[model samples]
Target: MTWGRARCALLAIPIRPNIRGRAVMAYDDNNRGLLLALKYGDKMEGVSTMARWMARAGRDILTDTHIIVPVPLHRWRLLSRRYNQSAVLANRLAELTGRLAIPDLMVRVRAT
Candidate 1:
């Protein structure tokens, strides 16, 4: 799968229990700005683009997906940030893919 000119890969870490994973974009110079802006600058306008990229990159996995869940933030972090970027992306992705988004499906027990 691919998004723009960036190549997508199915990431597998033998030590991890998960069977597969896919990154929407590489954390390189080309994508760093947009990622940082979305995560820290409240640049929500880019969420649609990012979610679309994710859908394209993970199309195979999504074919079998039943629900979309965002990695939750710790309570303190949630308070400080006032929003979870992952949740934003998850919601947008749900909209694009016609899937259910359970933004609160998981919770961070403590700060990491």
Candidate 2:
């Protein structure tokens, strides 16, 4: 199934692309850099790639969205991890798209 369909179980819908083609969804793929970053830290290239995607995707998604809300992180996890990938992505996205990044709209109570 598509990412949109996959998210339905949680009552979440993928943000459809606006006039431009963009959607807000999780980055489920584990690129080499991301895997490294997970094991190491932001020193990996994942940050740059993730940042680029966010900016590009944000522009497309914001074409129809007045606001962008990222998948959230728990406070403890946020602190422990020292970073929220989705939030970082959203922040870069908001800057590139000129859209508001509402990071607090969604909260993650747990992870599966």
Candidate 3:
């Protein structure tokens, strides 16, 4: 599906540095589980939940954001797992905030 196509294909990986930067994350309390679930546990159900939390955290800047870009997965990882957590997160977040998910802006020179 086109939902996580960018992430599925493997390319760029977006890293959020701060709230004032390109991305805003939700909850700093014990996020390893949540991230792991989304990344490797087949927790697609949490996309909406995560998007809601992300939206809440980024409410102040949602208006400033035009496109929600997902951090792409490495080709090898995607080939093996067949999914990308960041892709779904970005798409859901964009849908919730009425923005667009731009998956091609940041191109990766090499997979990390």
Q: Specify the highest-TM-score model's number.
A: 1
TM-score of each: 0.81, 0.56, 0.68
Each candidate's lDDT (Cα)?
Answer: 0.84, 0.62, 0.73
Worst 10 residues of 1 by lDDT: 8-17
Where is model 3 more than 4 Å wrong at Cα?
1-29
Count residue pairs with overlapping backbones in model 2.
0
lDDT of 1 by residue, 1-112 (tens): 1223333234432222233669977899998999998888888889999899999999998898878888999999888888999999999999999999989866799799
Error of model 2, residue 83, in angstroms: 2.2
Preferred candidate (lDDT higher): 2 or 3:
3
Predicted candidate 3 versus true structure: per-residue lDDT over 1-112, tens digit per residue: 2333334335465444223533445556777777788889987877898788889887887877777777777778777777877888888888888999976555554677
Clashing pairs for predicted structure model 2, backbone only: none
lDDT of 1: 0.84
Query: Residue 1 lDDT in model 2?
Result: 40
